[model samples]
Target chain A: MTRLVAIDWGTSSLRGALLDADGKVLEERSDARGILKVPQGGFPAVFEALFGDWMGLEGARCLISGMAGSKQGWVEAPYCACPAGRVEVGRSIIDIDVRPGSRIAIVPGLRDEHDGVPDVMRGEEVQIFGAMSIAGLDEGVFVLPGTHNKWATARKGRVAGFRTYMTGEFYALLSQHSILARTLDADAPLDEAAFLDGVTRSENGHGLLHNAFGTRTLALFERMATPELSSYLSGLLIGEELRTQSLQAAGEVVLIGASALTQRYALALRATGTATRTLGAEATWAGLHALSGFLDADRNPP
Target chain B: MTRLVAIDWGTSSLRGALLDADGKVLEERSDARGILKVPQGGFPAVFEALFGDWMGLEGARCLISGMAGSKQGWVEAPYCACPAGRVEVGRSIIDIDVRPGSRIAIVPGLRDEHDGVPDVMRGEEVQIFGAMSIAGLDEGVFVLPGTHNKWATARKGRVAGFRTYMTGEFYALLSQHSILARTLDADAPLDEAAFLDGVTRSENGHGLLHNAFGTRTLALFERMATPELSSYLSGLLIGEELRTQSLQAAGEVVLIGASALTQRYALALRATGTATRTLGAEATWAGLHALSGFLDADRNPP
Candidate 1:
């Protein structure tokens, strides 16, 4: 029976699972192991320190993905290029001397060039590939949402191109430090109607940068309620992304990166004219498993 | 000799100068003294407790501005309407628990409703009016840059209308917390061509909202050095503000709010086809010193 130890390290946290050949998690462990928070060149040490108890087994293969490969990590890996999807798992991902795993590898994210502008991503690419693997689909789009939202178009086991948006990051900054922050006393739920209203306004030619502060004026003037403003702002930012990013690709299948924080985006994204479905927490774990399955079937390091 | 106390109490800070009739400072002192920072209804007590030494001088008067008269301050004062230059200082301004000064009054800021948008300014309104007092010009435009950047048009001592932009706050949020924050290292003087370059791009029908993420992409692609991304992002935001806000008001005299933070907007203002000058600090003090001038000349209780 083949066993897989999979890791999904994200911007601020690390989670892992030891799974049986059938894809059921054996014993899972997680810790505050985000790459940004880790000390310089301390990825391996911190991971082992947090999850050493889970590594009691012998001769098990391990796979890792996420920002752990960027400059802030223990070792840097070059980002894969455009029309990029499922790069071969790097066998010698890093020469960190540590754990006794039989073999170790890291999945590469996707990248693309637009108008002389280049974009790159790491963890979400693997998840997109994994989502595709499970769906058994060809030529579709997948979106992984967060502070740095990632959108990828993949076909025949390759990502054609992808884009990233600063929705979550922008939300945090405006909510915490800016004047809009002062006015917001409570968290607001995502209002699809409000979101659509924002999209309509944006599509009607309200400049996103120009009308950003007007949301406050709207609140002050009592034209829009305070809570609805959040979703409106979301619509404004996401609406821009939909219109601008869609110029190149007419994506068919919209695989949403779903979470408590992400479900709000699906509301605004309806304006993009795509068929949407949410890939839940299981899909993240499933995406990692898909990579493991590919590796096992090939058994080759490319 | 007439003694006067000039006080400026803002949201988070308070500054006061005890001066002779000649405007010579006899003593100056400030504490953790914003209207918001101080305890509620503690204004009269705090003033007497803190400035007791400067009080009880014969024929002395005091002038106050800022949130001391908003709905939530020590007492409520009606807002002066638009095209607002300088409103006459109020006789019974604050609902003080105890009468302390020989003569005291508060200057109300301007508020206006334009195109269905309601806007208000408290202390800066006083400062701007003070600026016009020095210039002896009745009709002009004023640019008060801050967390909420405002472009105001005034005519014949009345503020006509104003629009607020979150340019400064947006820049702070993007540089300190967003993906742009991760991409940027520190502050750097942006290329004027690059800033205007971004403005030109925003002016296009494409919308500046979707294009903000380009800052992150520029760094990932190595097109921009990591450190310069902040400035570039700054350029993009301010550029959008210039293109959008300049269309809101018309006035040849761009009296910038006097501040280090506000000064950064000078270059951006100059780009908007307007002559810009920083408001002199003395102008505000002189305008408000009228408690000993205009009001006294009228022999009013204020």
Candidate 2:
């Protein structure tokens, strides 16, 4: 596998790792080119300022992933659909002529329809494929929980498809912007009992899309505490979500997408059933590494 | 019984009706001095502008209810506790050393604790009795659905007490200010099955708060139409509310409060159960009328 430039560019920052053919990080530098900040003279200046000093970067090839490939980022490379195995994701690179740096290419993100639902991803597609490597590539489910949590299914080391749920974002907005916002403990953690209770309730035929405002009633007339009410609200959401996705996900190993914001979901899933395990953000490095290998293999047939 | 005055003043408008010796609308007038706007304006201008012609309103005593009697309204008056029948809801009959011809007495609204929960009411106390009148004034549960849907229990024409849920206000905020707002059908009636479906779903167990984002999920994943989703969401919220309150209410008739908003709630209730009925907003008026009769009986020594 030829060593080139590795990039993990997300919404708030651009991180580039200069690697050797052996996939060793020789030197690394990062800049603020997050998706949210791109409109303010993003990716180009940041990439230049951070990697300009790496001599090997002058002629080496470039492989990038993350939101930097989004329509709003450094170079808008439309996402590629899956069966993406790292090689296709990392190797099908696109060039950003904005800067002079040998042969440059960006790893395409992932988007596909699964079970009649449309799904999408930007930088994390590479990481997902990467994580599949160390975790051992096989048929399974991969999750990345956040404001917009992604749940993807892969078979034979190729991502079959994925879907997105704005549960976290909705929770955040309702917890802070609307009337319920006044009652939320913005910093509180999940109430496990509440989550388990939610799961328990769902099994009894409770539906998420049917009943979300039970939170206020519980608090107002029932006199349930605020924190507990919030947890219950989250539980109903996560519970309903699990109910929606679980049938198709049975027996598939649940690879929880972890970040600080996702711990609650991880906890909820534990009680809600469906075998699961955790992989942290740092694992994205592994995802990046695996993508590099896939890119190499794709470019040179055995 | 001498004829008196009737008033219905709210957040944005002031309505005054001068009744005759038999409690008929002799003359009426209204203005834009809802409490939120003229918080500092005294009642003289408001009353004069509307009922100025009745300066010599002979044999006329006036009775008033609403925010006009709030702490910030014309004259500050404390609330009367529940189970309170025909309590003066406004400032006492201070002679108009200032007004000259009318023995003006503002009916102070009622307030009270019911079932260990803190509760209060102002303009609606009379409406409670009015509704109770139709519901048999026997022991039963009464619901005044609106921006603050009140669930009150009454025994023999007196308000036992009630709990307020910000159902209407919440529906407004969510559908207009929050993302859920995007799903509403500008032309759809509240009678849509989807709305009732939401109410049913609310009662389904996971409850309303659980299914709050169902509209969004359905739209995003299935490309479900918006107006249908809106009706479903509405049903979901109100349904959860009804479910919770039903349990809390036990076995009592749901005497609904009146207004455009209350009517929709009545429709939703009719779709679900027969224990619900819409009550007039003028029960407070009739109760005040009854109170006026009670007052007259006291004065005449029957």
Best by lDDT: 1
In order of appearance, the predictions have TM-scores of: 0.76, 0.64
Q: Which residue pairs clash in candidate 1?
A: A85-A159, B83-B158, B83-B159, B83-B160, B84-B158, B84-B159, B85-B157, B85-B158
lDDT of 2 by residue, A122-155 (tens): 8777667666766776667777776666777787
Q: Candidate 1's residue-wise lDDT over B1-302, tens digit each?
A: 68877777777777787888876677777777777776866888877876655667776677777777676665666677666544444332443335643566666766766445466777666666666766776667677766676777767775667766677777777778766777786476556555655555555443444457788778777887765676667667767766655444454545555565444456666666666667755655766664345445454534
lDDT of 2 at A249: 39
The stretch of ten residues in a row with the least summed lDDT in candidate 1 chain A is A88-97
Give the CAPRI rating of model 1: acceptable
In candidate 2, the second chain superimposes onto the true chain B with a TM-score of 0.83
lDDT of 1: 0.65
